[model samples]
Target chain A: MPFTMTAAALKIDHLGKRFGATAAVDDLSLEIAPGEIFGLLGPNGAGKSTTINMITGVTRPQTGSVSVFGYDNRRQALIARRLVGVMHQEIVIDHFFTVRQAIRIHVGYYGLPDDPGWRATLIERLGLGPHLAKPLRELSGGMKRRFMIAKAMIHKPRLLILDEPTAGVDIELRRSLWEFVREINGQGTTVLLTTHYLEEAEKMCGRIAIMNRGRLVALEGKETLLNRLGGRRLIVTLAQPLATLPAALAEDRSLLSWDPDHLTFAVAGPGAVGERLRRLALGGLHIADLDMRKPDLEEVFLQLTGNGNHHPAAEP
Target chain B: MTGPLPLPPFQPWLPFLTLLKREVLRFLRVSFQTLLAPVITASLYLFVFGATLGQRISVLEGFSYAQFVIPGLILMGIINNSFANTSTSLFMSRYLGNIVDLLVAPITAPQLILAYTLAAMLRGMLVGAVITLIALGFAPLPWVYPGLGLVMALLSSFLFAQFGLIAAIHANTFDALSMFTNFLLLPLIYFGGVFYPVSILPPFWEGLSRCNPLFYLIDGFRFALLGSGDNPFWLSFGISAAMAGGLFLWAALLIATGYRLRN
Candidate 1:
């Protein structure tokens, strides 16, 4: 088969995977364009990892087809795999080899000769210079993740796939890592990332696909996704406790919450924020402190997945 | 800052060689377990079996008992090491999930299989050579056809390595791998007449030994080393080569299907 460069770096069509009786990935399809960062956002067991496995040739989907850079993944796996690089969800490494040695071995697997120049560039890019000589066993959780990203980039693949790359990383490290990812994408490397950090997706991905129960429930631009979830919020905290909602504000009760001294409400849209404040003042509820939380990715994600459970901590 | 950089030129064989080197280095890094231990074990077998059995049985057609068993001992070492290397490497990679790195690479299944099996064969040959050298301490080992012995050893090593890879793919746990080694490999090697000729067995058992592929491998190596094999040299060579070919094809098929490598 001949090779051609195209606008879409990856095109997954009607992909589905079944493990005996359970369907792990169901009828998933998406198109990732070159130079674009795409996010696969979903909860655990939502088939995010399974979809990645299919795209990278680590696992075959029982039904449907995947094409990478115009090469069919199942039919031209070698070529497809050549164009893609994957950083798996698990932080697995050969404990025996130092970071430099591991990077060398990974580069070799792609049949690329060791280039000290390229290694140095990656070391600087991923902030791994200090840990170059350290074995994987000796590295901290965040450092190990950085090393994995560096390893994936060793071959300079056209398409990069990251499955939960920041699972155990700290906040500062994640910010820097996302910056590096942005730098790579700026250089025209297509990135397909699966992350639990909804904010990361909103910041990095041009397009996001939300998966749930082995199904692709939502796929759209970040702004469009948030718009679909409706509007922002206006939170009010009072100095005195309130036993019940004032009768005049009864119509907004579904969108409002009341505690002894704290009151919160979901503002329906831009116009609703003004009306909500006017009604609040009319009810004579004196606010001690008021905060308006913007409609962030977390709210959008919760509305789409229909689960209000907050992540214990934001993933790095 | 501007446009995307073009990918560097592709070098097809470079990755295969690198993976092969990694496999070799992995086994060599633990030479005490992969090489020296096998050699010592073979030597002990030679000392005990050759010394005790030679007193009862006359030298088998011009070769001493110690000399007669050397080929079988080397072949045995080759089989064990080859199988062990491939199976353990693959199983460990799978268990640790590092195999995903190989699977996602641009490398083909055939290249992956060849790199791994070739590494296993190299280790098997190294172990076999060490055992042959160790056997020299007990008695002077002669090779009627040094070239033929080398060829037989290599072919047998490749065969066993392929078998071990296939077993690794099918196995889910370490116990499954161990079961095949202990219940199948050990029995087949011993019953295939490594120490004694199959002609001394009951007619029924002798017929069964002919069916064991390892028997043909040992017979071919023994023919090259002693020139007094139980079967004709051509017959042993033909059977062993055919067995190797079948295993190679099966391994290729398994990898192509992405059998256990896929979810």
Candidate 2:
């Protein structure tokens, strides 16, 4: 995809934060195009939360600025905040509030008029109607998370930031949350997501930014990032087991591993599969089955993050 | 693929009102701890003092001991409950990490201060009204200048609410919060002439009591109801108005600076 410097939904310019002598986010700059699911991936303590804090105005940045929908977050915080909604990493609902009351109060804060229809739709969609009258303390963990989403969506903000939204939830709930997020994004809301689940990010995010030690390590389209790693593994099943590797395959033995009738070769690129298969054919190897696997976000993430150095088997 | 979102009409008052409603409901939902408990404690104070000391001493002219103590008790409830309403609510929100709702909202620092102070004042007023009604059983409940009485009650509540927000912002632990109430607030209440008039104290102690803002609040409130107090009505009123305005501005500045509440 061609990169253009059009208007952005969210923009961060040379943002930096520090606690005493240690820098949390150092000179970070990025712009998220409107209506895209942008993924922010980082290891623990890599300044993802600090950047979110600066964007949300929970913590003022020592350097640079954040603008949401053309409004400088610090100078025009009220206007900037109105355009943004955030589902916090923790379930931070007030224990004394009923589900309905909590959503109403949140809506009121954005100066949005009370809309019963929209409220009902949100409750029904999040499956929180039955818990409307129950205090937050009475709800289950997943229910509280759903209620948090309901609160965040009360004003139908143009930008939604989800920080680890599905962490610790069951698979079913996680999928449901993803669907709800996608549904809202489909309605023209820009989404910024941070998650530990690379599979989720790979499946959902259009573009991904990886951070390490308060710096941007990689940022690109998901496919571009994955392809840039140039990692592919080919597994071939031979018709007969071989005690010794054939001469043609022996030269490629470093890339090839054998287990019974199956041989796995670590190919450098997707195009190498054709060349390797042609080589095997010439070597008089009877191939019963063949499978080619392109690198996924996990492999790329591990590589860019240098996790591959310490733990080579970081990705399954 | 997406068009611009229609911006909502900026009804600024709605956010303030909603925040006030949330703060009020927070305490009303836990009436046992926020309301009934304070009223019960006030009643116990009234019973212990009015029953034992009422029969022996008459502190002021043309008034029984119970009548003289009633206004002080009502004001005490106002100060304590008002401060507790804001301090406890804000501290609890911070402790539980739920204050992000308010911090991230489209409300300014002054607006936030107003919402918290007003809600706290409302709780304080409600508690004060209940205690006054309960005190009627002990005394006739004088009402000389009803308008002035209302003004005094509001100013006192507003002042204490601001103080409470300041305390909540500075306090990091439960023990720290209690220190504000026990060491600072309770001493001010006791020394402010809740049980005895400052006029009866020695010259040095009376001058020292004048320094306590709560003394002015109680003295003014008593003068409004009974037409008599240690200081002139204007002095008390001036002191309260100054404290309320000054403390409110200070708290608003602190809030705007994101002191303690935000990183």
Candidate 3:
């Protein structure tokens, strides 16, 4: 593991940004270790992109600071920029150049000497060899995404920020992209990813941060986050219709949903699950069948934001 | 996609040089629209304005109207194309959202401005050269002070390219860019005394014409090219140079502050 006690690859402290009267990001703080694959998760307007922009020096923070590898973004902007690479969510390519030209140009922008063998290797590794001659505007979405990843990696920065990299990609391809990211992570590059796909975050990010309404709602190791904040779910298929609940159990009806032949509710944790079952049994109900669900990242996200819109992830 | 030529050793100037190369290549890629269009347009102007009007007006005592007007036409070519080069390049980059290339790069504000301005100068000078060549076909023109004429051409083009940069930074859409071009840029060119000398205007119009910056550019270029009047070429040079310097500073300030750019 490349994780260490050295300065963080990225550190954002008390960062804030406001547009007009609305706070896009509010006093957010985070420290991503040198070799960790960290995920920043949020609903559409949860300020995830604004945080990324601040980190990349595209948007200046009004309150605090962002540093890449100990170099402050604003004070040592050129040096910080040279040490980090970002692939924004928007797919913007210069139509004037081809993929080959576009990728090679990054070398000059960062003032790095070009290595043809490495360039060819990146092109081949990203499956961009065949499309190198095509104009950038002519490529399909998948190829463009791949090309953008290549562009981001051209300078070989120590840290890479990918904002929604697998967005709009098919399931199989999305998995492969994550596999490539894993390969890069294994090679000792720290990765910061923002993703709408909960399963993707669950599988890839060792740690995750969830944001809501311009605030950090949760930030923890994946398992820890799930255990602490992702409450368990239970569904009961009744032997008889849920009718005439006991007075004590009826008082908890706000958290319980009961239809003619089904009953559902959330269990706060392991202890709460048994207690809830005891209450249901005390109500003189026979349990025909029961289903218990393990909470995924989506459950945690929905619980935090109280919004289910993040799941579709395919939102255009 | 023609494979980029082999890379050289690393240097701090590489990014600036790379941007310059890309910008020069961008205009060259569309040679017909950027380079050839101005030449054909200048030729027609010379024939109609120079030939037909030469028989009627004599601004300078010893020269035909063709000789007197050629310098103005050449300077106009330089100004229009120089402005077009920077304005279209920056506006299109912003419009298409590819400006992220510069925003995220290690290039600084001064480097960005220099690269854009230098590319615009190349384009403006290229158009001026072709127009001057065509003017030679109209008559045998004297190259009185070719060096000074070149200096004036460069200074005027540099000034207008800064305007283009400013307009591009502030323009939100192509329509807004066109408004700058149509409303501000073209009017300055038309009233800048391209066909006839500003001396022919009434006292009030001539005073207004003198207030116009383009008038000094044409006046200086004409004085250097044909020695058409007693106006000192150095005076025109000083004014154009000062204005160019001022606009360059303004552009650098805008980039440094991230006005309408980083946001």
Candidate 4:
């Protein structure tokens, strides 16, 4: 089938995978266009990694097919693989080799002839010049992630697949790395990324697909997905502890919470905040502080995943 | 209007060569452990067995017992080194998560199998040659047919290398690979009549030894070295070649399917 956009980078059709008795990836389909940064947001075991593996030809799907830039992944695996580059979630490097040597070896595998200029440019672009001579074991977790990105981009592939690229990276480093990725995407390379940080996906990706229990639960534009969890929240800090909810605030009781020292209530619809304040004022309750909160990707993710437990420690 | 295609078709060999080069460089960088250690160990076996026990036995035909065990020592090195090289390399790649890099690359499965197997073969030959040279230091045996010996050594190395790759793919842990080597490969090498001629065994035991592929490999090399073997050289060569071909096809198929490499 012809894609909505002429330059389709990847197309996965009705893909399914099972590991013994457990279903790892269900009958899922997705499409990525050239020059687009598509985000795959999901909790652990959501089949995000499985999907990437299927697309990269690392794992064969039990049922269905995948195509890279229109080439069938199974029939024309070599052609498909050549067009795609992947940076895996785990940090893997040869501890003995220097960064320069490691990249050189990787570049050699793709059979690129010695191009000093391109190598130098990559080193500088990735901020790896200072660590070129340092052994991989000496580099921190963030540096290794960046090194993986540079290694994946060495062949100048048309599509780049990054699985949890910023899992342990610091905030500043993550932003800079995203900026670098944006620069690469601007040059027309399609990027498919899976991340746990919902904010990162909301900021970087125009389109997103959320996988849950090996199934695609939601797939749409970032805004469209966020809109699924309607309305906003208003958290009000009270001047004094309130013993009980006043009669005027009974209608919005579901959204209201009696904080030990601060009163926080969620507003379900537009202009509910004003009405809540009016009710509180009429009840003679004084507000010490008021804060407005919008529905971000995290809320939408929790709503869709349906597991209110937001424990980051459980993530892989 | 449609525009012409901007980029030319990419060359396929680039990724294959890249993987091959990496495999070669990995083993080559650690020649002391991978190359020299095997050579020294094989020589020790030759010295203790060929010099001590060989002297007690009467010379077979015109050749001495020391000369008789040379081919066995060399073949033993080929079998062990070839298996170790591929298995260790693949196991490390899997454990370190670098295999994903190759999995995601544009190279075909057959190419990957060939490249990895060839690197193992190179290591096998290097170790085998060192053992041969060490054997010569004790007893100088002329190669009855240098061409035949070279071909047999390479075929044996290729077969064992493919076996190693298969074992590595199936193995979930390093201990699993070690179990196969210690339990299967080690016993087979010792029982393959590498130390003594298979003629002295009981009828059933001798018959059983013939079933071991390593026997054909060692016997074929012995024939090439001393112009004498327990079985006809051509029969041994045919069996080894067929086994190697079958294993190569199986390895290629496993890699093509992504087997255990995929999640």
- The candidate scoring highest on lDDT is 2
Question: Considering every candidate listed, which one attains the maximal TM-score?
Answer: 1
Instruction: Report the lDDT tens digits of candidate 1 across residue range B211-238.
Output: 9878888988998988788898888889
Interface RMSD for candidate 4 relative to the native interface: 3.8
Compose the digit string of candidate 3's lDDT tens values, residues B1-263. 11111222346787898898889988987899999999999999999867787656777788888888899899999999999999999989888877887888889888999999999999999999999999888866788888988889999889989999999999998899999999998888889887778888899998898888887888899888887643577777787788899998898898889888787
Query: How would you encode candidate 2's per-residue C-alpha lDDT over A83-170 as one tens digit per residue?
Result: 8999888889788988888899999998888989988988987889888889888999989888888888888888899899888877
The true-versus-predicted C-alpha distance at residue B105 of model 4, in Å, is: 1.0
TM-score of each: 0.92, 0.90, 0.90, 0.91
Q: What are the candidates' individual DockQ scores?
A: 0.47, 0.48, 0.38, 0.43
For candidate 4, write residues A34-118 as lDDT tens digits: 7789999888998898888888877778998998777887887766776778898889887657898888877656556656887
Q: Is candidate 1 or candidate 4 better by DockQ?
A: 1
Which regions in candidate 4 have their CA more than 4 angstroms from the true location?
A1-5, A20-22, A253-258, A261-271, A308-316, B1-9, B50-56
The TM-score of the first chain in every model comes to 0.89, 0.83, 0.84, 0.87
Worst 10 residues of 1 chain B by lDDT: B1-10
In terms of DockQ, which candidate is stronger, 2 or 3? 2
Best-to-worst ranking by DockQ: 2, 1, 4, 3
- List ranges where model 1 is wrong by over 4 Å: A1-5, A253-258, A268-271, A281-284, A309-316, B1-7, B50-59
Top candidate on DockQ is 2
State the TM-score of candidate 4 restricted to chain B: 0.94
Error of 1 at A275 (Å): 3.2
- The per-candidate count of clashes, in order, stands at 1, 0, 0, 2
Tens-digit lDDT track of model 3 for A1-316: 3446447888899999999899999989998888899999999989999898888877878899998877788998887788788888999888888898888787788888787987887787778999999999899998898888888888877789999998876676677678877888898789999998889899999999999989998999999987753355578888988656666566663234567677666666347767767777888777899897766888678878876422221101
The residue ranges of model 3 lying beyond 4 angstroms of the native Cα positions read A1-5, A230-291, A308-316, B1-10, B55-57
